[model samples]
Target chain A: MNTTTVDREDLRTLVAETLDLDVAEVTDTADFVNELDVDSLMALEVMVVLERRYAVKLDEKRLAEITSLENAHRLLTEALEKKG
Target chain B: MQTTMASGASAEALAVVAMVREVQDHRGPEIPLLLLNCLERLTGAGEADVVIRRPRGRRPTAQLDGRTIYLSVSHSAQMAAATASYRPAGIDIERVREVRNVDGVRAHITGFLPRHADATREPDAHAEVLRAWTRYEATVKALGVGRALVPSEFAGNAEPDITFRGLNLPLNLNTATLHTHRRNQHDSYLLSVAARPTSNVVIHHDSDLGYTPANHERHTS
Candidate 1:
C-alpha cells in the first residue's frame, strides 16, 4: 500500500500556484474555465504538474474532472488510492 | 501565429463574430441554440433545413445544403460569444481582470506583454497584457487542434496596431482571409476571434447582442 495521503490544502495550493490564482479564489466550487477563466494551457499545466508531483497518470477524460478544489482533492485521493 | 494556421478555407471567406447576452448559464443548452439563431441571422441559413452536431467541449458543425460551417463559442460570466466562418474558426471571450505574477516573458507566457521598452510603465499594463493574452489564445484555438497551447510559439508583438481602442491591437497572424480581431467590450471584458477573412469578415459587438426575436423577425421578413 502506497500510503501517500494528500490533504486538501496542499492540493489546493498546488493547483493555485499552477493556475496562478490566489489560493482564496480557488474555492471548493469555482469552475476553472467558467469562473476563474483558466484557459486550456493553464489547465494542462496543472495536470502536468500534478501528474509529475504525484506520480500518477491522469487521463484526458479525467482531466475534465479536476475543475475545482473539491473535485481536484477527490480525484487525487482516488488516484493515490488506486496507485496503491 | 508562430505555430502554423489550421487548415480549412481561408480564402475569400466570410467570417462573423456574434455575441449573446444575459446568458444565465453558459453550460445550459440554450447558449448553443441562441448562437445558432445568431448564425441563422448572419448566414441566412434559415432558408434551408440545417442540421447541427455539437458535442460537449467540441466545436459544433452545421450542415446546410451540403455546406459545412464551423462555429466556435466562448462565454464569461453573463455574456457568451460565437464566431462563425466558412473556414475553420476558433474564438474565446474572457472577463478581463488583474494580471498577476508577470515576472517576465516565460513567467507569464499568456502575457509577457510589455511590447515596447516603455510599454510596461503604463498604468493599464495589467489590462493590456491580459488583452494580449486574448489574441494569443484565440489564434491558437483557431488552429482547430483542440486544446493545443504552445507557450514557446507565443509572440508578444504580432500584427502590432499599437493603439488602444474599443478593439485594441490585433494578434500576430495577419493574412488575406484570417487573423485575429480582438476588442475590449463593456470596458471590463476582452474578446478575440480567428477566422478566414478573405471576404470581408463582419463582427458584431456585445452592445448589439440584445438582438431580440423581433429583430430576427424583421430581418427575415
Candidate 2:
C-alpha cells in the first residue's frame, strides 16, 4: 500500500467509469465483483487504471483483495505509502 | 460448422471452439448459459446433466461421472472456445484490431519494449504488443489465477510469483508448454494455449465440437 491518501469519491469515480456504470451507483460498501459484474479481465483493467492514476506499483496480491469500494480506497492509500 | 485446427504434442487433452455467430444478443446475462451450451455440446452431456462446480477458494471445475476434468474457456471476435483434458490447461483467442493507443503503450506499458535501446526500429510494434498481451493472459489463465495476475510480472521475470486462493506458488515458464495458433493471412486473429509441462492438447475449432441436438435428444429419449 502507498502512503498517499486517495479520496473515496475519486476512487469510486474511477471504478464507476471503468465499469461503465453511473458514479452514483458506486457506493463504499458496493461489491465490485458481485454487484458490478466485474470478471477477471475487468479487474485487470481496474488495476491498470489505478496504477496509472496513482503512479504506484501495486502488489497483485493486494489488488486481488479489493472486492469492495472501501477496500480499494484503503489499498490505494497503502500502496502510495509504499511508493513514497 | 466452419474452420477447425487440431495439433498437439500429445493426446492428453483437447481444446474446442464453438462459433458464436451473433454476440449482439449474447452479452451479460447470457454468457453463463452460452458457455454451458457450448460445453454440453462438446461433452455430449445434456445442458441439465453437465455439472459445473464453483467451489469456494478454488478454480471452477466441471465434472462428469465423478471424474475431474481440466477446463479453460475464451471468447474472441466470433467464437466461444473451451478446452478440456485430464490435465489442467488454459486457452485464449484475440481478434486483431486497430492500435489506437500507441502512445498509451509507450507511456504506461514500456515493459513491451525490448531491453535493447534500438527497440524503436522494430516494425509492427502494435501487433507485437497484442501478441504479448494475449500470451500473458493465456499464461495467467493456464496458471488458474485468471485476472489475478499482474501484467508487469511477465516483464521482469520468467518465473512469476503467483498467489491463488492464498497459496504462494512459484511459476516457471520453462516448465510449461505453450502453443500459438494463428488465423487469417493478415493476422486478423490469434489463438494460444498453455498447459502443464509435458501434457499434450488437441484443439478443435468451431466445426468440431460434435454438438447435435437431435442426437442428444435420442440419447435422452
Candidate 3:
C-alpha cells in the first residue's frame, strides 16, 4: 500500500508523511531545512523512508541534496532511472 | 542577528581558550545574549558591536571586522549553549530522557558507527544512543557542513558503558577531541563540547554572570 511511483507529487506525498507534514505544506520549491526547520535526524528519516519506498539506494551525498521537493524529485528520479 | 554587551573579559588573555557558556533560558527560540557574550570573548573585541548571522539550519557564524568566527550551538529544554573558537567547532547538549523510537536510533547508529560496537548492550541504553547522536551532530557542526553532510563512518574513541552517566566520555576523533560530559547530576543533561580541543575546553555557566531575566535578551531578526 505504501509503494509510490517516481512522480513528483507521489514523492512529495511520501516525504510529507515521513516528516509529518501536510501534503499542501510540502510545496515543490519549499526548502526542507530552512523553511520547514527539518533537522538532521528528520532528514535521515526521510532518506531511509524514501529508499525503502522506491527500492533504491541513496548515499549520504544524495541524502543531503534532498533540500527541497524539487531537489528530492530530481534525485529520486535519477535513483529510479539507475535502478531501471 | 541580535545585539548585546560583554564587558570585563579579555580575549587576548589566552590564545587557545574556548570558553563555553550555558544559558538556562527557555524564553524563546534564539538566545542572543549568550551568543553575543561568547563572540565577545572569542573575538577579544570586548565592548565592540558583534553581529552574528544565524542562517536557519546552519551554525551561527560571526564576522567581526574582516575575519570569520567559527562556533557551534545546541538548545534543549531550557538550556542553550554556545562556544566560539579561532578554528571551526561545534557543540551539542541533550536533556537525558527516554527515547520512544529505540529501533530507529539503533538504525541511525548502525548507519555510520562500527558494526562491532554494541549500541544496545545493557543498562542506560538511551544515554548511549543520545551520546552517539550528539557525537555525530557536534562533528557535523564542527566541520560546518550542516546536517545534510554527515560522514558515512566515524571512529571516535567512544564506547558503551553500564551506568546512568555512561555516555559521559570524551571522544577523541581523528582531528578533534570532543568532550562528552554530564552536567550537575546524572539526570540533568548530556553535553558534548567540540568548541575547543581537549587541552583548551573551559566551560562557564551563564549563572556565574549573575544570569537573570533582564540579562538574557532576544529578538526575531
**Per-model TM-score on C-alpha atoms:** 0.59, 0.60, 0.61
Best-to-worst TM-score order: 3, 2, 1
Model 2: docking quality category: incorrect
Best by TM-score: 3
**Per-residue CA lDDT of candidate 3, range B1-221, in tens?**
11222222234432222333444444453566666667776666763565677897677777778777776777655556677666666666655555544455556564324234433222366655655566577666776766554434443324321111223322222111122234553334545544322324444564332321111101101
Residue B145, model 3, lDDT: 68
User: Which of the two, 2 or 3, has more lDDT?
Assistant: 3
Question: What's model 3's lDDT at B161?
Answer: 13
lDDT of 1 by residue, B57-96 (tens): 6668787767877777766556676766566766666554
lDDT of 2 by residue, A1-84 (tens): 334878788889888887678998888888876776554435555776788887887776565677778888888888888777
Give me the candidate number with maximum DockQ. Answer: 3
- The interface root-mean-square deviations, each candidate in sequence, come to 6.4, 4.6, 3.7
lDDT of 2: 0.53
Residue-level lDDT for B49 in candidate 2: 76
Better of 2 and 3 by TM-score: 3
- Cα displacement (Å) at residue A59, model 2: 1.6
Worst 10 residues of 2 chain A by lDDT: A36-45
